[model samples]
Target: MSASHTHGDCCDHQDRHQFSLRKALIPIAVSALLFVIGLLFNKALNNTPYSVGEYAVLIPAYLISGWSVLITAGRNILRGRIFDENFLMAIATLGAIAIHELPEAVAVMLFFQIGELFQDYSVGRSRRSIKALLEVRPDTANLKLGDQVREVDPKSINIGDLILIRPGEKVPLDGEILSGQSQVDTSALTGESVPRTVVTGETVLSGMINQSGVLTVRVTKPFAESSISRILELVENASSKKANTEKFITRFARYYTPVVVVLSLAVAILPPLLIAGATQAEWTYRALVLLVISCPCGLVISIPLGYFGGVGGAAKRGILVKGSVFLDALAQVKTVVFDKTGTLTQGNFRVTDVISENGFTQSQLLALAAQVESQSNHPVAQSIRQAHGKSVHKSGVQEYEEIAGHGIIARIEERTVLAGNDRLLHRESIPHDVCIVEGTVTHLAVDGEYTGRIVIEDELKEDAIAAIQALHLQGIQTVMLTGDNQAVADRIAHTLGLDQYRAELLPEGKVAALEEILDRASHTQGKVAFVGDGINDAPVIARADVGMAMGGLGSDAAIETADVVIMTDAPSKVAEAIAIAQRTLQIVWQNIILAMTVKAIFIGLGAVGVATLWEAVFADVGVALLAIFNAGRILR
Candidate 1:
């Protein structure tokens, strides 16, 4: 007698469904058993019409099975909301009872309850699957407080606090490793299977598991701002931004139920009064059947479920779609614009070539350059040191100076060694053979004499070529935008077979270039998506039709401004996101067509008296279950 049903609010509905199955089973069983007894009693009475024994047995069964529907319908009517599945089922069954069809009335309510139970089970399973996919939020942290570790909630841990991460335990907060070494598993966040090794001075993020060795970490960010928290927040709130198809279905159902009710009333009243041979009882029976068939439960439940499945599926692949509306936009993207650094190319710089001059050997040139560049922490300097592959001792070095926007001037072992860009050489009047280089270059000078030049270039990611090819296969144009010189940009574009390239653009220039791309796209063509990871890429990312950020190495501004975050920092996932969106949309439309087709056929048959009340119940509940199952396919 305590049965209740919910219509809107997907989270509330899912919570109710998660627990409703067990509560509903006992009442349904009792109602079904009593209905069987009532049928046997009616048979014993030789098919008597309106028999007292039949009413006594079957009326209780009908009330027991349908008490929730009747009460909900009455409450909604009082609240001035009269059109829903509950109203439809209540009216149809009550009309059956009025026509002395006690068995049919009881059967309808019992079958409807059975359908509700199945729906509960289906939705609960989906909710559990999605929960399992996003179960990355760490529950506790081991706070290392002065030689004693205390188990505490991750949220209670503050910045600058020390935390001990044991082997096989998850890192509780984003922090730098102060001591110890470990191989950490980042699959929970990045969807990558390979374990990453971490040592002292390396930073580890939250939600990563420590595979081996203990790590003493100094926390940098609180739990609220951790990577895991941001991802969970995006997923939990994704349903709030529904797609256009979902919104349209919601509005369609609101008015659909009322129109069906009016049409059913006309079917019952107008036929008997207008036709000579049409009896009121027969036409009324058809009206009840029509009412039962007209419920829009399939469309109401399946559309949102489909989108929820899509979001969960994307999360599993290290792609975080902020909302279903963004998913829709991704499916229609015709052009994918990429930022050169850290997006298609690995942002890490490496020394590619070393050109020597002025009687300096390659080894001596690199060693001298590395010794001077060692005083700097720039990425280009780091690449030089890494290439030298030896530690530099500053013991005999003097007068270490860094020229902003130029290079470095340091006197090592009484030698004035200069390591910087061409501007530095030009400022010192040191003449060099090459005034311009294809890629990033650093010129070295000793005692104001040109010694050599080091060529450093950012390497393309391993999957960069494959990613562009995949997008091209989908008929999407691929473009690259960068501030690198024209030679470097042309080389990368030709190597990746990109459709276009724009070079030497500043941050604002990148935004203007994106706008021009947007302008060239016709309204009938698709949208433009921009993929980037740097702080400078934030503005253009926000301007794109669908902004995708490389979450693994992307700056905070880029991630916050992006509509979709690719956690793996793989350009290939851009194409994958579009594929998932297209698949979700396809399944959604299939469900819509399936539900509408079944309802139209059954509604017409019921009105013409060819379909009985039993068929109408099957048509309504059966289509809903099928659609629910179909929507769940996206999770797979």
Candidate 2:
């Protein structure tokens, strides 16, 4: 089924109106004010012709818009380390004044101020997207004390408290349901779009909303231990983990600024002395112009802006990228491993068949099997109970034992009841078919009599095929790893067009599979991503180059380990994320190229005595404006 929800419309009416006003009126206000002042000052200085008050109006305009920036630039320079944006802008505007080009200097500063304002506006929009993703945290939770209901802070909720969840309400804590039935939207936590029907004895995650029925859940984790809180914390601080790209930019800017400064000085001094008849003053001025032109502001801003934009964009679409590193890593990911059940399929069990081997009827076999497995809290056992229509009375059972990693054995109505896998039946010397190639089958026996088998299948998600197809289109190889039987795993892998499959993998076995893929990636781009929607798959998710969690399902462990999260259960979003990252990186390079190109062209002209101080101001300021415009594409 298809679902839709609007995102990121949180701005208040006044805030939105202010944003629109700023966009429409701020520059115009500055420009019109400058023009009117120039006229008034020109009239006032009519007697003194040398006043040049027409040009002097720019000074007031510059002060209005560029004062804060100029002060910041001065402070940065005084600190003995001055390779920041403010330093570059200060040098460029000041150099224009050196040549006595008053109007040009004012225009240059004005344009720079406008560019900075645009940058601030765009970054603010990005922050809004981040905030929207974070707004999923609910304000309150329903706590049940005996028969009474109380509303309290979600943060104050503790483990084992019965939290009542209503239809259309987000499940406040990760817990097991004690009563009622409902379909939960786990898309936020699992990246699976289909809503899962959860009844009594089923686990529900925090942030998952109940679509139908009322559920009284026994919280298994505290509010602090809840998945939603951890996810919010991880995403909020993702910027702290510097990706290789960010580090490279940092190191590049650190050295590039110093080298450029030295080169500018060399250009100013060497040419006049070495070349005959070359003027020292002219050469010095040209070198300063070159320094003004090559500020590297575009390079610094664009690169980080690109990643930030990509992260914000993905977040808007319900994907939380922990850092720029994950965005970069995701682009380089050639191999992607997915956890089978919650990641690939819906992770809900449905009864496929009820086979009666001997002379027993189907209803008789189901009653005996459900009676034996009713005490266990396993998916397969739940499926058996579900088929039986209601919870069986425990009064009929005597000795009930749940074997780890196997099935349950119980004594019901003076008879030995075994409701488990074929191994449980074989151990009891019960005769039954050992295997099937279709769905997962659980064997049933009563007093050493082979009753029958019930086949169960975890259905694939509706968009599972589309999501896999989209991944393949992005040139990523998809693989499935699961602890399920080979036949079940293979069926899903085949249907989803998975490039590879590893079946019957234990939880540890999934980790081993990830290791093998990581080893192979070392020969290629040295990157791999693991996507899982389960708590058990957290280890493998962390082990991969980029850990991706389906946050819609609200798996706390998955959210903690994964570097990237899909807030909506849309597999196709994987492709969208990769596309956004690639696009962002491309835009960063484009801005860098555009800035350097204009600087190089104008600097060359300045050295040849063709580009004057006015031209120098234009090159410095105009290029900065262009780069800022290019960077805005990220918001789009």
Candidate 3:
């Protein structure tokens, strides 16, 4: 079948699995009742010629329970794909019937069907859990048109249109609140429990619930491009990118089933001829038991299910892992590198200190610097203007010139004012006593005389220190890279207790530095991960072993290039992501070892004639259910 058609069939099967528990029970109930009746009849007959009556009831019971398996096996045989679980089941039960072991044949098929029922129910429950975790898509929007409000599909609402959100309603689209105040619940998007108070001009994303007070919001993005839609799409497509372990299991199953089938055929024939004491009938029965026990249903289903559960669990914590492959990579990460601004720090600059010289008062220096730097859009310039707290009139400013890579030089009311870094001071032949400042310093020069400096700093994020400490506790190294000077980098690094810090590196230099970090981490050590949240960080984000992005306030380029997106924008989520990855891999391996060890022991027992057909059924289906339940534990 074509890929699309196969996917459609798979969906149909899942839909049936989701709702077919009651339907499935009916056939098994009837088959089980008939099997019981046939057993009683055979017991009462006790060597009479009326044994045909036992076959009469038991044949229908076996057919009812095993018909699907037999049909699927036959179809696969015609298509030259006979080595599968269904074929193993079909041949084992048919061999039992041929040897006149009617009760064992009926019992094997009946219990196998029961096992399949449990598997379906477990899988359906898992799918429902994941769906509930991510069911953030709003159904309708309350659109505000003129004086009237009308409900409409969220997809029909366009950007720039106003929408009214009542208390307890989910925000229909990404928008900014234009009026009113409310405490909005962001747990669905950020996995945070506390409701955030939002007011006029505050941006509200889709999937957030308004908790109190009616609000009017102007939509910023269409429904298709909203946060909820992107999250759904990311998770829905994650399974396509399988982990290496999942792929190995799949390849192993393909070769394993056929090899077991060949060995089973040899067991049926070679044993009777090679061993004089072995009877053909006894060896054939043992060969049938071996075939049933050797089915690889457990390993085939549980590995992928384990990874899927891991992804779902992480999503519940507001961490978006793009694929199982990334989760696997994250489990091996020994060092996490972070971009200083935005990722580790708040990226909001503020004037922290002001030093005066040449008899210039601190207030006077700040006012003059703010006025000169008014036209520049640099962050440091904005912080100075904010600290000054006054509007600059264009009439009082003239001859404004912005020196690239240096600072701003403007004529304020015909008095030359230079508000820039030390480079601008040196380039203009202005002398200053304080050449080196601890933090980001913007020097001021009034008419060839240096007038003190303003020290601005970016504060560390609230969770930065906690995040670093958590990584250290996990025995992973923490490092920071930034374009800021070494002094600022050292201060932030020391405050956070980071293992290493690289300062004053440009974007290209960050990539080169990352390459060195990767090289230093030998194959035996582990991979290196980079976390960043800027347009400049995209290249390094893409180059790292596992790239993480701060999605809440992160730039589009960085988010798009990242392998993992931390929606809460908390530095702490980085440690949580690694923890989740490691836990997921642990669960997956547990399932693998559990399935393999049980199968190996049971297969040996069946080949040596120590295990019956009933035990063989448990080996095939009982271990499968165990592994599936183990995989589902990740969701908990």
Using TM-score as the measure, which candidate wins?
3
Clashing pairs in 1: none
Cand. 1 Cα-lDDT: 0.83
Alpha-carbon RMSD to native, per candidate = 5.0, 6.8, 4.4
Clashes of each: 0, 11, 0
Better of 1 and 2 by TM-score: 1
Model 2: ten consecutive residues of lowest lDDT = 1-10
Query: What TM-score, computed on C-alpha atoms, does each candidate reach?
Result: 0.85, 0.78, 0.85
Q: Write down the lDDT of every candidate, Cα atoms only.
A: 0.83, 0.71, 0.83
Clash pairs, candidate 3, are: none
* Candidate 1 lDDT score at position 300: 78
Candidate 2: regions farther than 4 A off: 1-28, 35-58, 78-80, 134-154, 157-228, 269-281, 355-378, 392-433, 444-452, 634-636
Model 2 RMSD in Å is: 6.8
Q: Alpha carbon lDDT of residue 351, candidate 2?
A: 88
Give me the candidate number with maximum lDDT.
1
Better of 1 and 3 by TM-score: 3
